[model samples]
Target: MSRSLQTLRRLALPAALAAALLAGLQAARATEAPVSLAAVALGEADYQRVNDALVQHHVVPRYQVMAAAMAALDAAAGRYCAAPGAGTLAALRAADEAAVDAWMGVQHLHFGPVELFMRSYRLYFWPQGRGRIAQATGELLAAADPASLEEQHFRNASTAIQGLPALEVLLYGEGAEETPSAFRCALLTRIACNMKAMAADIVEEWQGGKIDFARTVAEPGPDNPYFESAEEATLAFFQSLYNGLELISDARLKPVAGASIEKAKPALAESRAPGRSLRNVVVNLEALQGLYEGEGGPGLGDLAVRSGADPKLEPLLRKAFRLTVETAKGIEPPLAEAVVDPKRRKAVDKLLTQLVAIKQILRSRFSPATGLPIGFNAMDGD
Candidate 1:
């Protein structure tokens, strides 16, 4: 409830052999009660636990942290716009990175409160091209009054210029640290403020500002527009996990790394201007991993094991997730540079390979265990 940044701070198995290549550490999971395969089905009560742990512990907490981080960015923008100086610019850039990191943490989620106003895409639009960013940036700066950036106006503005992508255009790159243009400053502050607003709205709605979207997700009913059954609600999180991973592999990893190292396209990398492209996918993997494990409670993998799947599937997923994160972190240079550099390019390739391996493992084990049908994404890359 407090505006203070400190107050709101509440914060996969792979193929098997290949996953062990990175972060060679093993994770231990607590033992869960056994349920026979005959009873593998999730009843209304079981679904409630799944929803409660995911919504209350996983989704809401992450959204609150994102709001706090965006709030910090807004404050930093205000401070710098008030007086442009090298020190202030440097502080602002740091805040920008922090905000991007927070967004990355929750970016994979695309349902519930985040869907209220299409806030997710507005907060962080990616796969965006440089020309579009350039044009959007130019148009905003060209405005005599910069009126389009007004809170009410940004809502109607093209999403291209609305959030992180546009913010990167104005806040980063050469000479970005040195500034005097009044229009550029105004644009930066507005984007930051709008992002802050979106983040707050998401957190509030999830916590019941407009509607307890989290509870709506948790308790599905015949009359409920969101979900008809608790199992359906449970599947939404599953879909997010799969879809989020696919987005990373397809959108984030595929475009930059390209099919072969020889055809790399660094320009397409997300958040690359701030050197957060690698960090972006890394955070995404970590968050998706959290979703796989149920955030803090009985993750799907744990539930699968209890539901009569191989008990080893849970740890296998854990190992796969660790390896993927370790592999991504292991990349020496950021994506843009690595995609172009010959020697380092293989590291990126290996990361892509590891990511696919994680997905394959999920398809084979996690899906069957949880009893959730394999969706289109789960069937992808097959």
Candidate 2:
């Protein structure tokens, strides 16, 4: 045979073998049974318990903390703007860090009142959108009159300049601390005040008598517009849990870690300006664990156990969560730095693997135990 023909035969044989292997894998996946948790039955009382525990232990407390933190941040910004001193600026930065930390803790609760007014996006716009935050914030600082930095003006301002991300740029970006212009100081106070207002609004909506979302979850009825039944409410909670994991895995970690070191995109890490990317992940996992274990209240695990879920499933899942958090905590600060380093990158990759394992357990075991429908899209935009 000709040399070219010989080379073609050699390549074709391996290509055919690879195609057969892929076909076999696809067939194996196709034959697998659909996951089902229908065996786990829950009554109205059980639903009420789960809902009440979640609100009492998870939702209300976290929002309250965030509101307090934002209020402190607003006060610090006001003081710093008024004084423009070294001590005050340092205090403002501290307050900013505290508020952001509080936000990371509650960020996983991506439903209810926070979604109504676009508060979540307003509170923290991520991915930076190729420096939209910097542009909008700079413009606001340059053009905004000190007197015009009111609540209404901030409400009407570009969403990019209304939240924590913009504040970070103003506080930590170039010449921000050393020689903050009067307009920049005013803008900082304005953003902090706006964040406080948004956080307060979320707490009010959740606790308000006019439309208490927590009550709606706990007491589902025909009158309620949001949840028609307890099961639907429970499913929504499960979706939140699942979506949190999805976000941590797909959005937060995957983008920074990438498929391999050569493809790593370290700059994509959330809250990179403040060097709290790993800290954010740690808090996020803790929040997910709280939802799973119910933080000493009736949570998904309790419901699963009560409804005949595998007894070992909850313990195993808890172990996985704890290990993931521990692993995350070990990673150094500024995930941007860690994402590019060989040693730290391996640690992050390991954590990602653990998160994926936890996700699988939730999909294959936890959901099946709780009667959470298989193939249900837990994420938004699905």
Candidate 3:
């Protein structure tokens, strides 16, 4: 079988797994006590502090890391394309992994410049739409002209073949390292450069005063198109937090873990092709935790504490976050392999349970404590 087809076959599983798991969870959660935010009013100064801290400590730093990693990845791919060898290939793979890690750090910021120009999709076209990545990569490999796979050409290429998933197929798929075609190397180089350019643009947009995102978010007004009030801006960030958690639980874990132990399908895990699926989960939780606790700056946790909410709440939430990350670390490497092993399967199951607990705290405790309403749309699954 062709390498792309083999990769697809290795990754494919029943779609019903996510649907069934979400349905059961939603039904079970329906009977739980409803959470309501107290009418604790936050002033304009409070909003400014939170927004400034988020921009300086969380947003800019994460994007800067992503840009640096992508630049490193582009250079590594160029080197490998110039000198096709096992050592170069290994270095290229390491660069790819670093870029993925950095992307996960800022992946939850689903707003602002990152949402412009289909940039996010171009950076990482995942879930692949049922073998689209494989099919597109196959066609590109079969018919690619080294002269045509340039920066401008990639600008108009199919979204499926323009991102990290396609790169993963080329770098780690069967025999990719063994026989590196010139056309393949050129394609990899072009894609890597394209991704790096996009990352750099995002960082520039956020920090170079091109958009003034910090001012726009902190000083919301009728003139500002994105947010009309500090409350609205706060809600947007909270929704991002909630959405990130949901994506990990529903999109990443549910399909692989299934509704029961007997039906677990390990191959369906995200980034499984490179064995970083579990690592992605760990980084995601770390980012979310950082956002919650402010990472040494003002954050939602601080806002909650100053609002006369229980001081112990933040510590409790932090403990839950720690437990979730530690539990995920214990689940054997390459989540795909772990999900199928008997002992490891139990660990995977436990990790899912811990995630659910964290989600519950965010909804039941964090939202009410911070006086932010739970974003129902963020949790609702179709």
Candidate 4:
């Protein structure tokens, strides 16, 4: 076989493998459910689509690009090493350019799609993309041989990824401007705020980690420095929540709104610990559930109106509660098992069973009225 054909064959395997790995990652994300404190949280399907797009186009393509670029570089290096006198500076420069171009071509294909995903995420989980960008930028900065061919290739890659947020804004923001409705404006400003907040959070998390770069960026205060710097991200999350509130006109929305607004006020005004903020969010959800039950909408009317508790909101609450319990399950076995003894586990299981029963009750009682799923739009006025 010709040398070129041989190289092509070698390149094909790793490229295919990279694509397969990326596909698996996307599939896993698609199958998993989202963790949310509120009933009106962003849909799991949207998150999965954004994640899959990022992985398939940008992230997955990155592996193949890096691999191809490296292989080409290595091939050139082998020739140079074997006949050092024959390989001129011009020859090395030409080879390097070829590899960089190849890498950039891969990046070009992936960049726009990934940027769109990041923009969508900014509408919901703004910090996640920012975290990734922050981590990548730090790694790029910390590399020792910044000018070496390997480092140069990575530098190109890093810069490409870093450029995504701004590109997203430029592309999506301009369009949003032409038709600036409350929703568009809210979403655009939210995206902008999220980018900065996400970047700050990323820096804080990097600093928190044991990695050398993390130590270099370390701040003196707060358990989660990201949360401290994540004001805009936190605000944007709440703004989305506010938008959700506007969508529902139920009387129950008033208290849920009150509680959400109360919690959001603190987060927007000052930087608080993420743990505290998250706890407050859970409280808001629980409060919303209660207010929802009290509004004379459905189910024996507020677990209080009947001999037994109403189960209308129970299923949604149950899912949220289960997510919390399941998240805790990932803790070290000794800690988890100790914190949640067998009795506690049994209690949780029994509660989940009750939640299922609640779903049945709500479905039978309310489905006839709404002609929709039991939980769908059941909140008063929704």
Candidate 5:
């Protein structure tokens, strides 16, 4: 008989049953680890449910939010360029921040529709080499014609000026306190519209436009191009978690903060000039939290708990992710400067330490529970 059925039979016995027998049965059951009766089968339906929930609830909505924010940014840029003023510039800056925050929430998701046509990079090409964004922005402005940055023409332009970093170069530096010349404003608006279109394209593709990457992810099969089974689809979701944290630790944080006190390279800090480098990582963690918990339904943690009956799995995951996010929250901003500040730098280092601990749990426990491997991410060109 199934374990669940067997347990039910034990419970259904008449109250007149011997007290000794009941005590023995209860003691025997206490020795076994608890399992989710629903997860015992580890079947197709469970995987399908997880895949559907993550795509619909966690992934698609974030991309949609990004698209909406970019649209607002485009409109704000248009308004500011039409009539430059303190108020309009302020509006433009607000919309820019909103667009960036929304982007960070979904930036870690590099696969699916976001990979199509390199939309992610076109949205915010990072590590653009400190002054590169300014150089690209200056060139576009020098052209003094919006056509140079319009969709068709700018599609092939340098990735640097094609996205958010370029917007920062125009809006965050020395002269940013004042409105730009009419021509510079025109280029800014053009870049904003192009980014707006890129965000919209990603959302539409995931939501069932021509690409329909979401469908590929949700409905894996032997004949399906992207994923052959639900397990493979699950790995992709796990990779997003693994890769997101890895990116923050290695690519985003360490390169800027360096190995030790004497080695810090503050200028290498990303999003430095804009003073939001740390905020981006925090929002990324928030998005990852949503992925782990599931936005409104069953999530990866449920799948992991069901997979191996690892009693410590869920609580460990919850604590690890929570502590990492909290650590990141504790760190102050102007990440560029903070990394070099002797007193403030420890908070940044502490966040790095937390990232390592969380990653260890992911590699040693959670990934195996979900059937993914340690270091399974594609960053090594494997």
Candidate 6:
């Protein structure tokens, strides 16, 4: 054999080894942590009933309220297609609430078990948020002569509850006041990502034949099994979930709203310089708030199904739970580092800290099956 041929063979062996390593890495990334859907399976008929209840009890009431609001807002929409000029928006909001009440009444009238449905399965899917730019854009799109604003809004709202991003909104709940439109889109995007996390649970259950809805939710005890250890896939799933929560909390995940009160501090001397009028600042802030809190989105039913029952589902839920806990803990520091204004930063810092606490509490009180940590208790199961 020639000397060159020997060298080529040596190089080829390492190349093959490198290729093998790369393949392993990719395989790890694709292997998902298992998630069980046994609890979601009530039976086919029962599952259908739950879906029906979701639409009737949770979804319908939400839609009724939103539709009423949209009607009033659209009525008030002038040539500019902006909000109404008179008491229209206020009255409309009231009407929407009343309509929601009426819808709720109807649910009770027929199902009678509506409250149980709401408490048992609805809260998980409800999106209780609002924003300006996205709201305006949504309104604009809805009022665009050709489309139904209320319908579009309903869809956006549905996506929100599902934890999926809404129609145009991007991230869900973060960004500059001026860029409400862009922020809206960003907010929706993040919400969609969160839904993707839930989707993992759904697909797992579907595959297991446990989520028929007709049967009652099953609980998988200690005897369940596990799948191949795809740490990389689990990490990616966790990352997506964390991104969704971070977007909700830090608001950094959304689009950078149009230039307004961004984080940058003017030069120290500039700080001494006159800034935008105080009145304008106040107005802008109010407008921004209006955008954030005005709209509604999708909602979850009030069912607390266990994800860890089946051998396949436990790892995914556990992984997801762990990710959620980590996200709650990590929210404050980054925000503290980012904000330039001391007062604003301090306020946000406090708010984020509270949110972290709330999330921790929710995890502890609500998450009985996942067996992940709640703050210090998180170490309990591990």
Which residue ranges in model 5 land beyond 4 Å of their true spot?
1-41, 145-147, 375-379
Query: Model 6: per-residue lDDT, tens digit, 1-382?
Result: 7533332233224325334434533443254223222333323333233334443344344434433533343333221124332354344334333322322222212211222323212212222344433464455434443222233343344322322112213222223113334333333333333333333333233224554211112222233222122222122222222333333443321221112237333221100111211222122222222211221421111212323223322332233333333433333433323244454444333334333432332343223323222345432457
Q: Write the per-residue lDDT of candidate 3 for residues 111-141, one digit (tens) a residue.
A: 8788988888888877757778878888888
Ranking of models by TM-score: 2, 3, 1, 5, 6, 4
State the TM-score for model 4.
0.23
Candidate 4 lDDT score relative to the true structure: 0.31
Q: Write the per-residue lDDT of candidate 2 for residues 50-91, one digit (tens) a residue.
A: 888888888998899999999999999989888888899889
Using lDDT as the measure, name the better of candidate 2 and candidate 6: 2
| Tens digit per residue, CA lDDT, model 1, 96-122 | 888888888887777877776777778
Residue 139, candidate 5: how far off, in angstroms? Answer: 2.3
Question: RMSD in angstroms, all models?
Answer: 8.5, 8.9, 9.2, 25.9, 10.3, 19.5
lDDT of 3 at 170: 90
Cα error, candidate 3, residue 322 (Å): 1.0
Instruction: Tell me each candidate's TM-score.
Output: 0.86, 0.87, 0.86, 0.23, 0.85, 0.27
Flag regions of model 3 displaced more than 4 Å.
1-39, 146-148, 375-382
Looking at model 1, residue 207 earns an lDDT score of 80
lDDT digits (tens) for residues 1-382 of candidate 5:
7543343333223232234334543453364325433334567777788888999999888889988999999999999888888899889989999999998899778788778777788888876565877887776677777567566888878888788988888888656777678777767888898888888888888888777888888778989988998878877888888778888888778988987768888877777766788988899888888888889987788877777545656765776577678778887778887788888888787777667656655665566456565564544776
Every candidate's lDDT = 0.74, 0.77, 0.77, 0.31, 0.77, 0.30
CA deviation > 4 Å runs, candidate 4: 1-120, 123-281, 287-291, 294-340, 374-382
Give me the overall lDDT of model 3: 0.77
TM-score (C-alpha, index-matched) for candidate 2 = 0.87
- Backbone collisions counted per model: 6, 1, 0, 1, 0, 61
What is residue 234's positional error in candidate 3, in angstroms? 2.1
**TM-score of structure candidate 3:** 0.86
